[model samples]
Target: MIRFYHAPGTRGIRPIWLCEELGIDYGVEMIEFTKEFRASPAWRKISPLGKVPVLVDTADDLLMYESCAMVQYLLDRYGNGQLQPQLGTPEHAIYQQWNWFAESTFARPLGEIVNHGREFPGENLIPAVVAEMQNRGEQCAIAVGEAIADKAFILGDNFSAADINLGYSIMLAERFLSNGLPESIKPYWQRLSSRPAFIRATR
Candidate 1:
């Protein structure tokens, strides 16, 4: 069995959702983000940076971090090709494209929005930063929207691991939609958020 170290309401939601989707018999070890929890020696051994979503592959004695990587790994190892595209194929190219975009373009700006919002709440500068972030987020959302517009999922008919990564990225950005998100981005978020996997992940 794999041991997943996670904190609720954090990025760990990505892998937790993947685990649930794959029907893997994984153990969830909840690690609160409180000062006391952060200082735990055991948790530190798993994640030196004290981040959530650290996956301990007990069989191989491998500890994996990063939500996207964990999701991809789970799909590759346990999904039995159900949620991954064939390598070097067009679908695989698109999978990598959107997955990288979600992590680099979407997740980064969205994180900046959250970080700056918390660091400078109610200040003029925070709003300005949020606006810039929202603009970047909107661009990424548009790209994702166009990709999934006519299809039911990001990979066009299948809910791939890329969807899990990008879907969560969209969800993170949606929390700040009231700040400066363009009207065009709403339906994209609605589509991603309405997925059964997304609903189960949040719960």
Candidate 2:
């Protein structure tokens, strides 16, 4: 069985959702972000960064980090080519494109917002940084919305790892939308929230 060390509302959701999609047997160990948990030597051993969503492939004792990499690895190892597009195909290229975009472009900016907000809560100087991050996230959201506006999934017709990657960004955007979001991104959030896998993952 695979062991997943995760935290709620974090990147851990990516692999957890993938596990559900693959119907794979896995064990989840939730890690609290408290000082005590962060200070644990054992947890630090598994993830030097002390981040959640670390997967221990017990069979081979492989420890993996980074949500996108883990999701891609799981799909490649266990999905039997079901949820991933064929390499060298057009669909595969698109899949790889959005997969990287979600992390580098979309999630990175949004994370900056949360990190800045938390690090400097109510600090006047930090508001500018937060606003900049918010703008970047909006741009990313619009791009994602445009890509999936006509299709049901990111990769043409079938659901693929790209969806898993981008879908998580869409979900994160929804949390911020309640406060305020770019008008162009509303429908995109709706489409992602309506997916069955998203519903299951949220629950």
Candidate 3:
């Protein structure tokens, strides 16, 4: 069995949604977001950083914590080419590009915004830093928005795991920034968010 350690509204949702879409049976251990949980010795072994998205595949005794890596693992092991392009293809290259773009290029700024805003709110909020992160996050959002705007999914006609990876970041940006998102991006999010798998995974 696969065990997904997750918290509501965390990046762990990405892999959880992928599991649902692929019809893979898995168990979720919902960890509450708190200092106590973050400091737990057992969780520390699973995720040295105490992140919510820790995947332990008891079947193989494999432990993974990175959200993007976990999503790719599930797809590679179970997708059977359903939502991914075959390796060595042009589409597969583009898929790889989007996966990296979603996490490193896009999720970085959004994460900064979330951390700063939450750790320092109201009068303590750093106007300049938040503004910078929001600006960067918005730019990344525009690129994603334009890419997925005319299509039903990220890779045009197919609903690929790239959408799952990118879609979760979009949700995070929307939750934190909540202002001046590219008008084009909002509808793309609506489309992804309404998916039964997305709904079920987050719930």
Candidate 4:
């Protein structure tokens, strides 16, 4: 069986949603989101960086930390070619592109905003720094909006795991962006968020 160490509202949603979409049976172990708990030796043994959403495949004696990697792993191992394009194809390349963009590019600034707030709270928070990060995040959001302007999902009409990867980042943008998601992205956002899998994963 696969065991997922998860916390509500965390990146684990990416893999959890994938499991739901593919109808893969899995178990979730909710973890404390508190730093004190995360920093404990017990937690560190499972997650070196004390991050939430550790995936442990007891059947294979495998464990994984990065949430996005977990998503890819599940897709590769159990997806049976469901939510992705053919391997090594241009469409697959674009799929990988969007997945990376969702995490490394788009989620970076939003995470910084979060880190900045945690590191410098209350009056100590720097407005300029937050504004800069917000600008960067918004730029990524605009790029995503334009990319999917005419398509149903990130890679044209098909719904793929790339959507699951990008959806989490969009959720973060909605929470952290000063003005929230731009007007052009609203319809796309509605479509992604309204998906039954997304709703189940989030809940």
Top-TM-score candidate index: 4
Weakest ten-residue segment in model 3 by summed lDDT:
173-182
Per-residue alpha-carbon lDDT of model 1 for 1-203, expressed as tens digits? 78887776678778877777777778888877775676688767778866677898878777898888888887778788877789889989989888888888888988888778656767445567778888888788777767666787777777777877887787777676555444555665676677676677677
Q: Provide the TM-score for each candidate, comma-separated.
A: 0.84, 0.90, 0.93, 0.98
Off by over 4 Å in 2: 177-188
TM-score of model 1 (CA atoms): 0.84
How would you order the candidates by lDDT, starting with the best? 4, 3, 2, 1
| Residue 87 of model 1, lDDT score | 84
Which portions of model 3 miss their true places by more than 4 Å?
Answer: 178-180
Q: Which pairs in model 4 have colliding backbones?
A: none
Indicate which candidate wins on lDDT: 4
The TM-score between candidate 4 and the true structure equals: 0.98
Give a tens-digit lDDT track for model 2, residues 50-133.
777799897877899899999988888888887887889987887888899988888987887776766676744476676777
User: What is the TM-score ranking, best to worst?
Assistant: 4, 3, 2, 1
Provide backbone clash counts, one per model: 0, 0, 0, 0
Per-residue C-alpha lDDT of model 4 across residues 1-203, encoded as one tens digit per residue: 88899999889999999998898999999998988999999999999999888999988899999888999999999999989999999999999999999999999999999889988999999999999999999999999999989988889889999999999999999999999999878888899999898899888
